[model samples]
Target: MTPSQIAAFCLQLPGAREDLKWGSNRVFSVAGNKMFAILDFLDEGRGGLAFKVDSDLFLGYVDRPGISPAPYLARAHWIALQRPYPMGAEELRAALTRSHQLVVARLPKRLRLGLLLDPA
Candidate 1:
């Protein structure tokens, strides 16, 4: 999916917000602090997208075409899809939703409760 599409999908999740970092990369985070997805836009051309995954999913995805461990965050079970992503729009959106859930689950109980009550 395009970066704009990814951003749109990610924002559909509870408390999801987009932040720009390293100038061009769009970072999607929930519950105020934790990030679940990133869309990297390079000066030369379109860049890849990265998100967190479970260990089992990480292993399975890394072995697939166009998928790899995310730079600097692989040890935490994050994965990246190279530019010209192999997955379809729906698949990418599902992954982003799951990643957002995973991050939200790790958030403080009070904050998580607030998000659930009012996911603005």
Candidate 2:
């Protein structure tokens, strides 16, 4: 997805918010301070996208062309895509949604309830 599209989709998630961090990166977070995705504008050439993936699926994702373990976050199972083209747009959206769900699942019970997220 394009940067604008990504920003829009992320902001639409329950209780999601965006902050500009490190000057050129857009950080999308839920429950206030926990980040789920990042769009890096200053990345060399055409920018990049990074988000957390299920720990069990992390290696599989990074092995794909155009994707790699996200710098500094790989131990937590985050992955970076040089661009979002390796996957179809719908697939990318689903991944983003899963990333949001994963982050939400770890949030405090009160915070999750405040966001009106189901306990699934």
Which pairs, if any, clash in model 1?
Answer: none
For each predicted model, how many residue pairs clash, with residues at least 3 apart or on different chains?
0, 0
lDDT of 1 by residue, 1-120 (tens): 777777788888878888888788888998666989888833223768889997788999999998988888899899988778888888887888888878887887888888782323
Determine which window of 10 residues in candidate 1 has minimal summed lDDT. 39-48
What tens-digit string does per-residue lDDT give for candidate 2 at 1-120?
A: 787888899999999999988878899998779999988834943658889999999989988998889898889899988765588889899999999999999998888998997565
lDDT of each: 0.81, 0.87
Tell me the lDDT of model 1 at 10.
Answer: 84
Deviation from native of the Cα of residue 114 in model 2, angstroms: 1.0
